[model samples]
Structures are given as structure tokens and as C-alpha cells.
Target: MSTHSYDAIVVGARCAGAPIAMLLARAGANVLLVDKATFPSDTMSTHLVHPPGVAALRRWGLLERLEQTGCPAVERYSFDFGPVTIAGTPRPIDGAARAYCPRRTVLDALLVAAAVEAGAELREGFTVEEVVADGGRVTGIRGHARHGSSVTEHAPLVVGADGRHSAVVKAVRPGQYDERPSRTAMYYAYWSELPVDGFETGIRGERHRGWAAARTHDGLTVMPFGWPIEEFHANRHDIEGHFLAMMDLAGDLGERVRAATRESRFVGTSELPGYFRTPYGPGWALAGDAGYHKNPITAMGINDAFRDAELVAGAVADALSGTRPLDDGLRDYQRIRDEEVRPIYELTDAFARLDPPPPEMQRLIGAMHGNQEAMDAFVSVQASTLPAPELFSPDNVARIMREAGADG
Candidate 1:
């Protein structure tokens, strides 16, 4: 039992949870943020922060700290589609012409530090044992500390910032929406001295296999990923071997990786289903992977997490300040999140299937060459700042063709 009452209790103190708690505390709400894992610890992540994600960090006042931590800036993008390569600079986000890939160890710790500075009480190494429910509405949580003490904390709202297998999401059992089946299994690791020339590269390999490589936190991260689901299950026992084999299939990235030092153990997942669960209920809400998750094929997880933190925080703040009903305010967060993410979710889901590109896609890829503006638009889809339709629309196609003189 606890006498302390917080306005919000956020579980899982990573990208999503920490920011939500930080914003709440900054709005003068008493917030408690807890995580099972300690800060400065590495978790499995693709780690690329795209331009939109960088903008979110800037808005949260953490981008300077991230830049200070020695994470390299990625200024360009290269997409190798076998017959064609589209190379261009990513569009700037609020004057930031580059993206970043900080190690999760560094990023998470920095976010937690910001939350603490904002007056959120962050409890690392604390595991939520159960969701304390009263009359069918979540009132608090019972959790145990790493060193073995049980404590209960109460709050008006309990947020599940936990990842895909979120305890808070499970306990609440909120209705699900936009659920899509798992498509691609992915494996990735860090390497040293794998040269990229400050460009992040995405290689579309033959037979539907693909790989992405980018500079991040003193090393190069290369991920080999693809589908058919069956292959993932068959290769479960020999993941490292399978991962290396997949990387070997990755055209130019394979050669560079072969020449570089393997600096870390390979990490990956066989299951990555995409979905959006209703983020809020009676007294509980979800954010990050718990509320909405898309396939990592687009490398949008961290960025989306950052974006949703601002959204959820705003909604919660509005409700707490008596500007709107809590449920209505939280629903606004869900609606906006859906509107912003659904397109990317569908695009990434399509990519994750490892299906053969349609003839139209092949033509579109060919069209991007020799046309820098079209190429930039294409890269924006990857950065997530531009919607998929923006590149594929008829008007854009007409302009691209005009620029290429193919329309004539």
C-alpha cells in the first residue's frame, strides 16, 4: 500500500515511456516512471533515428544531448535495387539535414535523465508484478524492486510504455485495431570500420532478401532481413549462421561487412507482427510498441516512439488540466496516431512480406535514377517524413517523368 498519489505512472522507461513521463512532469504533473531494465543498458534495436524522429528529439530538447554523445550523423541515403541505385540526401527536418543512429544504451539513459530532471521519479530495476485494479479501473501497480522489496503505487493514469510484450497492455486487454500478421524475421549486429561514406544504405537483394546498413554510435549497423516465416523457424537454432548467410546475399553491403571487424554479437527477432491497439481505456493508456507497432523493415520504431510520446503527453496533459475529459483527450491521441502512422504501417508491411515488387514498382525504381528531386522524394518515404502516396501519386509521377524527359 502507498499513500503517495501520482498523476501518471509510466512503465518501461525507454524511448516511449521516458518521454511521456518527462512531458507530464514538465507540465507540472507528478509522474512515476519505472523500468525493469537499468538505464545505459542496450536493448535490441535498429537504432536509426530518421529526420522526423530527430525533430521529435529536438522538440523534447534531447537532440543536442544525443549529438553530444558521439552518435554519428547520417547525411545521405543509397538504395540499391539490383538494376538501379537511387542516391540522394534526405530532406531536412527543421533545418536538420541529417538523421542519427545512437546506441539504445546512450539514447535511453539520456531520455531517463531528462525525465528525472523534469521531476519524474524514475525507478529503474523495478518490475511491475501486477496491475492493481479497483472496481474495474486501474488505480495503480504492485511492483518489486531488483533488491527485493515490494511496493504499491497509485496514480490516476497508468501508462504502458513497455515494448511489444507489454505487461500493462496485457492486463488491460484493450481492443485491438489495424492488426497485421508477422511478415519478416530480421537479424542485425554492429561492426567496426564498415565504411559507408556517411550514407545509410538499403540493399534490396535477389529472391526477396534485403539488408540495411547505417553508421551508429562508433560502429556500422547492418541488418539482413526477409520473409516466408518458415525459414525463420527452420533457422532458429543456427541464427548466427543464418544471419551471416543472409548478409552474404546482400550485394555490396556483404563485401563491406566481409572486410570489417565483427564488433558485437548478432541480435534479431523471428516474429514482428504489426498492429495498433486502442491506446487508452478507463484508467490506463498505452504508448510506443504497446499501443502501435509496425514492422521494423522501415527502421521507424524509435522515431515513431518519439513522436507518440509528444502526442500522448499532450493528450494526458490536456485531460489532467481539465481542458477535456481524459477519455476524449486520449482518444484524440489514438486518432492522430492512427492517421499519421497507418500509411507507413501499410507500406512497411508490404515491404516486410518479401514479395516480389510489382512491375509498377520496378518502373518507379528505374524512374528515380538521374532525377535528384524524385530520388529525394523516394528517400523521404524511407525517412518517414513523406507519405508513400506522395511519391507514387499520378501528379508526382507526371512531374518525375517530365524531369526525366520520359513523358516526351
Candidate 2:
């Protein structure tokens, strides 16, 4: 048994946790980032970075490092909305740009390494048992080390950056977190020895083939589909086979998938949602996906996580400097994160409702799908920065409403 305390203790060390821990550590706070999994582990994601997300990385100095790590620059983002293929510049707003494609495995590992370098103590392969609270305030966490040895760590602040199903979140914000499912499941993998057509220019193979990036990582193509869970479960394995079938359906995409010498294991995930609203209490705060786990319909995971890390870092930095109260700093963290995600989630949730194509949303997508500049901004709206009205701007959206014969 061991007992120790710090200024802050962050739970979960993967995508969300690691980055937040790194940010606070670099600011000179004693931080510990705990994860149940080891580094370089496989994570499920479409792995496409959005414009604002990429910009956030550049601010954190991770963009330069990612480019140095075989990450490709992405200049084009096209969407095959099952009706039309909307192709546009990679940025949503003007002067916005980001790198093309990088696998989550590599991206996450890079962030973790950066966190370690910044002086964060990472405790992997450890299971969190409970959160320690003092008079209605969270003060520490109880984690079981690998050998089942019990360890307790105290901290004035405890951060929950632990991804979607965060254990720390469960311990802290059980009632404050509310989320609505996006009704979409994702399946992804990698391939080599296959030359993908229309994808040779991008990063790896292709992404968002159905609705995401074309090629990213080392010739790896990721595909995601929006299907009702109960219905999708009936043909889950068949769905994986269907994904392979599509890659083989197109001549270039087909030939590449068929001839690949290296193939990554196929993975599937369901319940990717647009759950926001975190619980920020005294001496405790939520970060990353824990704070605002948005719908992945736009593939905003990596960049969103990076942005959250920065948000938390700035807040923690302020608290450490005695310029901010811990609770006040946390509420600031919550407010900023919520504000950033609200607009994007609005667009994403509205986009997901296209099965019946609600009149207004139908008009929106129909109007902008043809304009490349509009399309870039369209994607930007789903990216967590551009306001929702920007997408529905009278001038920007006038074309569609005109086509629908709705004037004035």
C-alpha cells in the first residue's frame, strides 16, 4: 500500500487523459495520469483531424511533431452523403488548415510521450477502484496496481479525462453527465500492398469512404456508417464483410484492399454519441471527451481531445499560479469546453437526423453540398468552432432555400 498526494491527479491516460496531464505537468504542477491500458495500444477511431482541431494542435506544438511522425497533411475533405459527394478545402472557416491523416495509435502515443517528457507520472495497467471525497468534495482516488496492491493518491484536484466510459466520471459525475446516442456504429482497419485510386494523393489508403477522410496513416483506409444499433447488430459480422466488399467494389479501392500485404485487424464500435454537460464540482473537473463527448459523425475525436487538453492546461496553470480558485478555474474549464462543443454538436445532431431529412436540415445540406467553399464551412460547423448560424447564413444558405423555392 502506498499513499501520496499532489496538486492534481488525472485519471485515464489514453487520448483524453494523457494530453490533459501533459498540459498541467508542463505548467509545473505535480500530476499523475492513470490508465488501465498500456501505450501504443490499439484505439478505435476514424482518425481524421478537423481544421480547428489541427489548429489547436499547432498551438500546443504537437502539430509540428505529428508531421514529423509520418502524419500526412490533409487539404481536401469530401463527403459522400449517400446522395452527393461534397468536395472542398480542408478548412471550415477561411485561413483554417490542418494535416491530412494520421492513425489514432500513433497520434495518441505521440501525445503520451509528450506528456511524459513534460514531467507527468504515468501509471498504466492500474484500475481505479473509487474516488475519495472529503465533505462532498473530491480529494483523491484509489487505484489498484498490477499485482492487486492497493494504492491511494491524494490531490487537491482530480480530473476526469478518461474517454467515453470514464471510470473517473462514473465515480465523480454519475448524475451530471447526460448523453444522447448518435445511432451510428463504426468499423475500421488498415491495409498495405494495395494502391487505392483517388486516395494515392492523401495520407494512407482512404477514410470517410462512406462519410470520412479518404486515405490516412500508412495506406490505411477507415470507413464508418450510421446504422441503428439493434438493426446493425443483426448483421455485425456481415457489416465488417460489407466494409471489405465496398473497398473491393471500386476498381482502385478494390484492387488495393485485395492486394494488401499488411492488414490491420478489423474493429467495430457502437454508441458513439453527442453527450455533453460535465459535472464540475469543488476540487474536481472533467476534461476532453469526459466533458464533451461529441458525435464522431464528423471525425472530430483527436482534434477535440487536443483542444480539451489545452483548455484544462490553461485552467490548471491559472490555479497553480494562485490567480484562480480551483472551483472557479474548473467552471471556467467547463464553460469554455461547453461553449466550443455546442455549435458543432448542433450541426452534427442535425446532420444525423437526415434519415428522413427534416425539411430545414434537408434544405441546409442540399444547399451547401454543391459549393466547395460552403462545404468547407459546412464541415467546420461540425468541427466545434464555427457557429451554427455560419452554416445557415442567409447568403451561404440562400442558394438551397431558393432551390427549395423558399424566398425571403
Candidate 3:
């Protein structure tokens, strides 16, 4: 077997891995980024990146590249809860008030190019066969390119950005906490000639159904419909039928969608499980869905991946550059990551259940209707630019109720 060495090795070169490798190489670290899939490949994703994620791209100097791809910026978010539709703009985060739903083929390639440009070595189509360890410390990886002989690469650090079913995670056997079973199943398709003004989400509380639509690259719209996990089996057999029927619950969206042409096959999953894994060990670390995963109902996957990429990259750089101990740096990364995502994790778990909102939440949503400020705050909460607690605080909720002339 061939042997090589680097300062760090990153697995799964998509959203999380590419950014982590890019940032580390930018920090002057010798990094190796490997992925089983070649660039421009599509993956299943909600594809929505909120304002904070947009800010991350801007910081990385890739926002303009994304814009040049003809992906539309979603400046408004509308939540249709059957009885009331609350539409408003989320508050800006770092001068980014808009979201984008770029196709994964475009976005992931952009990221991989950035990583390569930053001097990270890329091994496309490399599949990891083993995460090698020595004395309980991750030492390197054994993998090979498609149609090639297996080779070994050693590094002080091995990072897994390999998604929920991470090979590295399986090898390291990191402890997981707050584990929950799948709560919802979702299916989506891309359609041509179906234009949406911005991001639109609909909830049919009575039917325990939800759907969302957003305009993406090539002027196509991507729409997803979801149901409780209990119904996943029944619905999987007739995805088109159930999808169209759910769209019918969203007013005229069904009519508009019917008038459009489907440009892609239906894609979906019912395996979403909410949990956070212990992200770091002696010489290994996790980033993105490899460490934390939750339902895509809130559309937070891409955004959170961007955020954690920066965090893990910074942590690894600090450690490798002798700014701190590796364990300390990774520990800090774990703590901060957990603290940052706990709120949204809880919110996503609850929403994924497709249960009707509690009386208080229903009342709060009702009070926000027709009230621009309150609705904006609500949207901000959904975008994760503002904390949910801030908007749902007793004082804020009461003030909104009073201003909207709704009974408390």
C-alpha cells in the first residue's frame, strides 16, 4: 500500500468537508480532502441556506459566484398555516437578509473549487475503507480512488464530514446524545415553469401535512411535501399521488404546480433521526451532519453545515498551529457547536413531528398576522437569525397581541 502524510485529512468533500479544507488550507495547513463522488454531482437536500449561511459564503468570497449561477435570492418567507398566512422578511444577519436555494450540483462544485484553489489537495472518487488508529488516536485513513489500488494517508487529524451515516463515526464509535427516531418523511421534485416569489412554507394542521417551495437555479422551483413518519410507508408507494394531494392543501399552489413541468424525478427520505454525536476524540473530529443531524423540516442542514465548517476549521487550525492543545480546541468546538444548535435542534424535532401547535403558539401566530413587525420577528426566528425565545418571550408576545388588537 502507498503511504502519504498531511497536516489533516478531511473525508466527504461536500458542504462541510470542502469548507473545512478550504479554511484550513487558507490558514496555511497542508490538508487532504477526499470524496467518493466527483464534483457537480447532485445530492438529496432541502437546499435552502439561510441568511447567516449566506454571510458565511460572503465571508469566504463565494457569494458572488453563487449569484452568478442564476440562483434566485429568496428575500421573503411566507408561512401558510391554512387559516392564516404570515409573510415577511427575516431580519438581516451580517448584511445578508436573503436566502438561496442553489442546486447541490452547483453549490457543492463551487465549494470544492474553492477548497482546491485554497491549496487543499483533492482526491475525487476516493472511498475510505478504514480510519486507521494507533494507541486509541486516529492516525490516518486507508482508502482508494475508484478503479485504483488502495493507499494509506497519515495525518495528525482526521475529520469526518461524511453525513449522518459517517464511516469515521462508525469506526470511532462516538457517543451520541439526545437521540430521537425519525419524525417525518419528505419527498420533493424540481419543476420547470413553476415560479415562486420567495420561500413559501405551508402547514395543514388538521391533516398533519406540510410543504415548502423555493425558486432555485435555472429558474426552476423545488417543492417538498411531508407527512408524519407513521405514514411514510403508506405514502412511499404513491409519492406522486400523496405529494399532489398535499399540495392541494396549499391553496392554488397545486394548480400552479400542475400547470408546470416536472424537470426531475421525485427524491425523498424517511430516515432523518435527530441527534448530536460527541464530535471529537483523541485525533479525530466531526463536522456537519456527521456530528449533528436533525429533520430538514426547518431547512437548517446547509446553514448549520456552513456554520460548523467555520467552527471546526478554526478549531483544527488553532490546534495544529500550536495555538492550543488539540483536545482543548476540539472540546471548545464541541461545546460551542452544541450550545449553538440546541435551540434549533429542539425546534426542528418538534416541528418534524407534524403535530399541531400548542394553544399558546397558535395564539401567538394569530396575533402576528397582519402585523409586519411581529411577522418579521417570526420570520427571523424561522431563519435562525433571531432566537426563538426572543420573539416568543412573554413581553414580546403580549405586545404583539395588544398591537394586533387580539385578545391575550
Candidate 4:
């Protein structure tokens, strides 16, 4: 087996891993980025990068490249709840007033290229068979490429940016908290000529059903519908029928979808386990879904991954460069990550249950109807650009109700 060494080894090369590698390499760290799959690959994703994520892309100087790919900017968000359809633009984040839904095939490849260009070593098709450890400290990784010899690489810091089922997490056995069982299952497919103005989410709270549609790359719209977890197995055999039936509940959106042509086979999962693991331990650290995962109901995964990549890269660079102790830097990464994401994590869990809103929430929804300012703020909360507590405060709710001529 061949051996190699680096300052940091980043496993998984998608949104989270690629950016961490890019940022770390730019910070002057020797970075080795490996992934089991090669570039320009598609994975199951909601694909919506909210405004905050778009700002991250801009900061990294990759936003223009994404725009060049012809993925349309989603400038508005609409939430349909049988009784009312609240449509508005979310408050901008860092001057990025628009969201995007680039196909993962395009987005992931772009990120990997940025990482390589920043001087990170790329090892595509590398399967990490083992996360080598010594004296309870992770020291390196052991893996091989397809049809290639096994090799081991050592690094003081090993980052698990591999999705939810991360191998490093398996090896490190990070303690988990706030864990929740899967509450919903979703299936989606691409459709050609499916015209949608922007991001649309429909919630049939009474029936515990929800669906979303967004225009993606190459004039295709990606539509996803979800059901309570209990219904996942019962509807699995006939996903197409159930998917259409659920969309039909969206009224006009359903009409348009039924008239369009599906361009891809259905893909989905019921394995979305929500949790937060101790993000750092000894020489091993976690980022992206490996450290924290929640329901995709809010489409926050990509945004959260981008934010955490920046956080983790900074922390890792500080530690590796001897500007701070490794434990201190890694701990700060966890602190900031949890602080920034906990609110959305809780909201995602609540939405994933697919339960009807309580009477108070229903009242609030009604009060915001026809009030563009209130509607924008509400959508901003869902977009995670605004804190839920701020929008849900009694004063704000009462003000909205007053403006709508409804009882507070």
C-alpha cells in the first residue's frame, strides 16, 4: 500500500467537503479531498440554495459561474395552504435577494473544480474502507480507488464531510443528541416544460401532505411530494400514482404538472434520520450532514452545508496553523454551528411531522394573508434568513393581525 501525508484529509467531495477543502487550501493548508463518486454526479437533493447560500457562493467568487450555467434565479417563494397562498420575496441576505436550484450535477462539479484550483489534491473514486485511529485519536484514512491498489494517507485532522451515513462517524462513534426518527418520506422527478414562476410549496395540513416545485437547470422543473412516514411503505409500490395524487391536492399546480411530461424516474428516501453529533473528537471532526442532519422540509441542507463549510475551514485553519489549540478551534466550530442552525433544525423537525398547524399557527397564517410585508417576513423565517422567534413574537403577530383586520 502506498502512503501519503497532508495537513487535512476531507472525506466526501460534495457541497460541504469541496468548499472546506477549497477554503482550507486557500488558507495554506495541505488538503487531500477524496470521494467515492466522481464529479458531475447527481444525488437526491431538494436543490434549493436559499439566499444566504447564494451569498456564500458570491463570497467564494463562484456565483457568476453558477449563473453562467443558465440555472434561473428563484426570486420569489410561495406557500399554499388551501385557505391562502402567501407569495412574496424573502428578505435578502448579504445582498443576495434570490435563491437558486442548480442541479447537483452542475453545482457539485463546480465546487470540486474550485477546490482543485485552490491547490487541494483530488482523489475521485476513492472509497474509504477504514478511518485509521491510534491511541483513541484519528490519524489517517485507508481506502482504494475502483480497480486500484489500496493506499493510506495520514493527516492531523480528518474531516467527515460525507453525507448523513458518514464512514468517519461510524468509526468515531460520535455521541448523538436531539435525535429524531424519520417523520416523512418524499419522492421527486424532473419534468420538462413544467413552468413555475419560482419556488412553490404546497401544504395540505389537513391531509398531512405537502409538495414543492422549483425550476432547475435546462428548463426542467423538479417537483417533490411528501407524505407522512406511515404512508411511505403503503405507497411505495405505486409511487407515481401517489405522487400525482398528492400534487393534485395543490389545485392549479396539480393541473399544470399533470399536463407536463416527466423527464426522469422517481427518486426518494425514508431514511432521513435527524440528529446532531458531537462534531469534534480528538483529531477527527465532522461537517455538513455528518455533524448535523435534519428533515429536508425547509430545503435548508445545502445552505447549512455551505455555512458550516466556511465555519469548519476557518476553525481547522486556525488549529493547523498553530494560531489556536485544536480542541478550542474545533469546539468553537461546533458552538457557532449549533447556535446558527438549532432554530431551523427544530423548525424542520416540526414541519417533517406533516401535522396540521395548531389553531394559533393557523390563525397567524390567516392574519398574514393579503399582507405582503407580513408574508415576506413569514417566508423569510422559512428561508432561515430571519429568526423564527422574531417573526413569531406576540407583538409581530398581533401587528399583522391588526393590519389584516383580524382578531389577534
Candidate 4: 10-residue stretch with minimal lDDT? 1-10
- In model 3, pairs of residues that clash are none
Candidate 2 Cα RMSD after full superposition onto the native fold (Å): 4.4
Compute each candidate's TM-score over C-alphas: 0.95, 0.85, 0.98, 0.98
Each candidate's lDDT (Cα)?
A: 0.83, 0.66, 0.90, 0.91
| TM-score (C-alpha, index-matched) for candidate 2 | 0.85
lDDT of 3: 0.90
**Backbone Cα, N, C clashes tallied per candidate:** 0, 16, 0, 0
Candidate 2 wrongly placed segments (more than 4 Å): 1-3, 92-96, 193-210, 244-262, 353-356, 359-370, 382-385, 399-408
Q: On a 0 to 100 scale, what is the lDDT of residue 281 in model 4?
A: 91
Error (Å) of candidate 1 at residue 122 is 1.1
Give lDDT tens digits, candidate 4, residues 286-377. 99999999888999889989988998898888877788887888888889888888888888888898888889889889989889999999
Model 3: how far residue 67 lies from native, Å: 0.7
How far in Å is the alpha carbon of 394 misplaced in model 1? 1.5
The local lDDT score (0 to 100) that residue 186 gets in candidate 3 is: 85
Measured with C-alpha atoms, the lDDT of residue 88 in candidate 2 is 59
lDDT of 3 by residue, 1-408 (tens): 545669999999988999999999999999999999999889988699999999999999999999999989999999998889899999998999999999999999999999999999999999999999999999999998999998889998999999988999999999999998998888889999997868999888779999999999887899987999899888888998888888778787778898999998889999999999999998899999999999999999888889889988998888877898878878888898888888888888888888788888898888889999988998898888998878878888889989978864
For model 1, what is the error of residue 344's alpha carbon versus the real structure, in angstroms, after optimal superposition?
0.8
Per-residue accuracy of model 1 over 51-150 as CA lDDT, tens digit each: 9888888888888999998888888877777777888887776766678888888899999999999999988999998898999999999999898889
